[model samples]
Target: MQLLQKFKLGKSKKSPSKGHANYAYTTARVRAMKSKILPKETYPRLMNMSIDEITRFIGESEYKEDIDELARIHDGVDLIEHALNRNLAVTFTKLLSISEGDVNFLVGEKLKKYDIWNIKTLLRGKYCNASTEEILEAIVAAGRLSYSFLSSLAAKGTYEEVISELANTEYYPILKGYDGTNLSDIENQLDKMYYAGLFGTIRESKSKDRKLFAEFIRMGIDLKNLVTLFRLKKSGIADPEMMNLMIDGGLRLKHRDIEKMMPLSFADFVSELESNPYWDVMADVVRPDMVSLIDIETRLKKHRLKSAASFSHVYPISIVPIMDYMLSKQNEISNLRIIVRGKAANLDDDIIKEQLVI
Candidate 1:
């Protein structure tokens, strides 16, 4: 597999840093917090429970406070959805609060994706004339941008007004190009900017942990690109058009390699992936004629979390554990939402089981 072969090709060039960040305190705190995450065995029990039962289950667990706080105004899946978002936001914000120096900076950098996500949500909500309440429901203030700030943006009367509000920020440069019909384009650019900025942040870091984190980031990019390729290929999108959608700087699949794979037929694409490192994790689920990419996507997500946890053990005192905890916490939230929402939608237990990472 050229993908695996290329993994041995070279490493990212790095520059030295004189700044200091002792992560022992942060890592310890994160580990303690991670222990509170719902155990894997809990999902099976949740699967058998009614929506109310599941709600009550989480209500008595880590999410109890969130449920209690929101129970007055929301119930059922709506309560779960809002509580999940709030809990996630509080969880992530707590991460920033507990860390200092480079640790805080790195955590903040990773969390910026939520900021980008909120911006995209605001733009999307405004683009579709979605009500402010509807837009705010989608916001997860997990980034440096506060929930109140995002809520205010969502309440903006126009996309242009939202853009005007963001003018002083780094995203304004790209947001200015939004001409009403280019929401997708704007969203794509914002997404690209995030990876670009994140890669740049770690590119010159002298810390071994940051370098390892870079590897983890690249692995995520590779999986994201693969999902994008799979989705576009399944949709019969032309190969040339696929390049524009592909993000740069994957760990195994470089830009050039993705370029080469772009022109291949869907079957050929699947064949090419057989040589990729991720193929082992996804091989059983991937096929040229697969009906949906959801299974493959879900498998990759599980793999990513597994990989993060595995790496954390090798560098217990470093950012790896912190990142692992972050991923685990997010996974816990996602699993809870899936169970509650799936039950509300009358989805089968087996289907919900397939979606849960644990």
Candidate 2:
């Protein structure tokens, strides 16, 4: 709590209490946080180093404090992973606190998605028969939901109890029907409800950031749909079942688009996607140096990051910049983990770089 209060989530007195957003100071704090993002040049240098060298390199960077605290207990990639997740959670929790008024509304609404994630994580852990400690480690702790709340959720002995605990949230309605079904189906319900809740908020929003956030949500939906479609296609699932699995509200890949691509082979769908606005996002599938589901998903995530950065540059004072920084912080944690783990495994530099979202 002391650490959380110390940072104050980039808040300053300049933040508005009502009416308008406090773009000035809100962005000021966000910019400072964004500065800590790994430079493009760093990846090139780190790729050549061994795992020990990579750990040493991270110790000298912004991760130094986290690395220092955990170094005595864990080493190598595990140390890096724990430190990074801790840092990521702290950063995001700060963002949720500092926001106010319109900025608060936007950030808060977006952060609710993390609660959905926690529910999913708990359900998954219970379904897999994973121990409570194992489930606890997998949590990100970045959401508006408190650490205690999530911890309690993780300790639940059954999926029904987990869902019952979440009954007060929007997720309960969707999950209630699937109490006895497979966890995968329940997880799929959570995903659909989350996107649906997002679009519902979008409908009620009157802020300038509405269009920006709407697009961000759409990009997420499209990527999610693509990933789902590909997996279902590979499984030989029928169109109706695949459609049920996909969440709507995607920007480029609409109902018509999905309908058109459903009957075609995966190659044909990739070719069809190449000509649309989603080409850059799906480009990894059409032009990957290392063809893989992982590569394709990484590219899609990178596209969203680049788009957020570009949007923030053009609209610096808006909510876009804050969201951009928050996302960049999360991606930094992930990218560092990728590099650390990849280096620890002694994988080739190119292979590691291919998996990076930056």
Candidate 3:
């Protein structure tokens, strides 16, 4: 507690300044949050429990407030989903609140990506004609947009109205061309725009902290592009048009390499990946039909988690640890969701293990 007070004092001293003080505060808060992430063994236990048991388990854990509040209105998977979103919102909003300087600015910018997510969610809900309550429940609430703004957009009820509401925000210009299209097209456009903005923001940021954030984002993009490339190849879609779906700024593969690799046979594609930086990490999974796209995706996520964990220690005072904790927490949630669903479906243990990313 004394150490935390000292750290908080250091942060407050720098809060009024534009320099290192903000980073200190953000890093301190992030470290505290990281300490609260579930242990690895928690998921295996969650997997064996029923949905009601799972809810009770989470209620006894860090998600207590959210679980308690949502329990009255929802149950089962719906309850878990709402609790997750609410907890995400509370956690991220706290980050914004505690950060003082450039750390605050950087986190705010990175979080704008969530705005893009919310917009896409709203658009999809509108297109599907889903209820406002359903759309509201689906939002993650970890973005730069206020809760009121997101709630308003979700309640608007029409694709055009949602698009028009977002027009005044940073995402409006990028999504303008895709207006009135299918929800998938809108989703794709939003993804492209969000990533493009992320890359641009990375380039503009001069702080070492900002650079670390960019590397994490790049790692994610690389994994996503690799997955897309492999999936398209497996589906027998070799056209150049398919490459358009791949995002840029990956540390491992360039646009040209992605384009070139698209034409390769599955064997060649696996060999190409095996020879890259991810080779040693992914080498064990490179055999015959056993290497399904889902397996590759799971491996990629593992690699990213490992990479993020390593990077966290490389610069302890930066945002990397916070980002790593966020990813790990989300992965824990995803792993639990998969296990619960798998158990509920009565899948065999080996089959369930095969599907888990952990």
* TM-score of each predicted structure versus truth: 0.92, 0.84, 0.89
Candidate 3 per-residue lDDT, tens place, 1-358, comes to 4357467667544322245445566777788878788877776776677778888888998989999999899888778878887888788878778876666666676677788788878877877789998888888888788889989888885777777887778777766766566668767777787777777767865557667888889888888887787778787678887877988778777888888788887777777776677677667776646546677778889989988988988888787877887788778777766776776678887777777777
Candidates 1 and 2 compared: the better one by lDDT is 1
Cα lDDT tens digits, model 2, 1-358, are: 4246337634552422344456688888999989978887888788777878888888898878888998998887788888887777777788877877677767877777777777778878887889998888778777777878889988888888887888787667777886565778777777666677678767765456777778877887887788777666555565665567667788877977887778876666666767777776565466412245776778778887898899899998888899899778878777878888887777888888888887
Question: How high is the CA lDDT of each candidate model?
Answer: 0.86, 0.76, 0.77
Candidate 1 TM-score over all chains jointly: 0.92
Lowest summed-lDDT stretch of 10 residues in model 3? 12-21
Clashing pairs in 3: none
Clashing residue pairs found in predicted model 1 = none
Worst 10 residues of 2 by lDDT: 11-20
